[model samples]
Target chain A: MTQTSLTLCCKVLCVESDDDKPLASPADSLALIAQERANLERDLTPDPRWMFWPWGFAWLLGFGLFFLRFGPDGRVFVDLPEWLPLTVLSLSFIAAGLITGIAGGRSAMQTRGPSSRQGLMYGLTWSIAFTGMGILFAQYGDALPDDRLGLLWAGGMVALTGALHMAGGAIWNDRQLFILGAWTSVINVAGILVGPGWHSLIVALGGGLGMILAGLLGWLRLR
Target chain B: MSDGTELDPVIHAQARLRVVSALSVLREEDKVTFPRLQESLRMTAGNLSVHLRKLEDAGYVEVTKTHQGRTPATFVRLTRRGRLAFEEYQEALRALLNPTSPSTSSEETL
Candidate 1:
């Protein structure tokens, strides 16, 4: 038989062998399989720095939103300039973006993979969604009572964030993120039910605490 | 049909098979660092270096040496030829396992 035909015949025989065993010696094949499994586990494990971005973002954005709504006296902190708050909020987002981008880039380079693209896309989509939501609120906000409108916007934003996190968790198979998303959704809904006055505090405590807890868990796992 | 003799000897070795198998899981463009490979295989650095050198000499694997910050890093990847050879080896192995089958008899007649 020609070399090519012989190889083809061997390939046909290999089909069943590939499914049943990798090598004639069962023990050696098992060891090789175990080693490969370990390698995969290592690849899927996330770095601690990855968890920091969300933690920092939650704390920064939560504090910024809370401060924007009310000061220590349960009243608006600064009525002097609307532009100033918007600028601050924008700056906070920019900082969060930088943190995530730099850390994610480093991690991807180390791993040599395309996994980081998913995270970048997720962040980009969410940013666009938030901008669109803001425009919608501005257009229709006057129809609702001022207090009710604020509650609706705040609750909606939190719920959107929660849903995003849940989706990310499901896609990535991360149970912690899934739980955090569910926790945030429930807390924001409860806050809305409690009354419009409590919206800022609920978000501040819920979002901030949830992110902190998740970050801590991730850090501990890395250790 | 029972051409077990056709298996690539380079990849049939247990250690080499393990290395190739680990690398086969990665994307074609991806390269795994030496330390990572060593950790995954639970092999000594010197032993892995020796195995890697053999694979590289045979043109079954490509090794790149570069610096990560001040430290030197070695990256390894399977070549296209290596992947094909491994697949063929698996096929040959399967043929060897099923020597008494009808397909083997037909090939033997041919």
Candidate 2:
């Protein structure tokens, strides 16, 4: 009785004739029943593109790299003689993740149940929250210096964003969101290598353009 | 004819019952699309049209024709009488299900 199955049943029952008239009889109730069974099985298949573990593992890789570079010297990622600019950039990345996850999640729930759009939205929402909280802790707290804080923040946010994406993917029954989450993890690693300027652009493009495309794909398919 | 009575059993069969359930979902919403109902009920367009004509004859539902994009869409809604009849039918069903209940026996006595 899922909506897709119901729609498929309707499509199967429709007569393909030139005349815009109704059929004389119910026209093979058995056929409709058979079609329904097939569709139900198709709906039950699990998607393969789950992203949570992959992103976590990637962040772990980044964590190792960060420690390798700065651990011996006892300087964190942000403490490499960099200014307060990295702090500002981290804050922006976190904000973007939060905004996308919360708003996109709501919109996806409203429109298409748990389709691709919902997964994308949910991923965006988590991204914003995940990144934002990390940046907040890095800047305002009495914990560690900026560079070390940045490494810790990036590792934690990348892990979280990946987890959210995986959850959304499972809920929507789509792997695309999982892939996006994995991409965010990779982007985080890239950010570590490229410095703040390049990281900001990458995060914007990944969250912004990526979400718009997902939304458009849903609109086209549903409409 | 002078007193209010329930609809005939013959008129309450297959297509009409399907129409009733479909219309029930649209009681709060102003209207539902023709194609939407036809698809929901898994009925052919002509079979649906025939049942719809009967409902229209009974003054229980209204149909409006409009264009969605280039295609003609028929929107349907239950009339006030249709809503009342549906409620009355539900009440009767509840009574039938619990005929020995105190409230029902008392009403029967009355």
Tell me the DockQ of each model, to 2 decimals: 0.20, 0.03
Per residue, candidate 2 scores C-alpha lDDT tens digits across A32-114 of 32343333222222212111222223323333344433443453544443333444344544454354444544333221213
Cα lDDT over the full model 1: 0.67
> Which stretches of candidate 2 lie above 4 Å from their native place?
A1-223, B1-11
TM-score leader: 1
- Could you tell me the TM-score of candidate 2? 0.37
Query: Which candidate achieves the best DockQ against the true structure?
Result: 1
How good is the docking of model 2, by CAPRI class? incorrect
* Model 1 DockQ, alpha carbons vs. true complex: 0.20
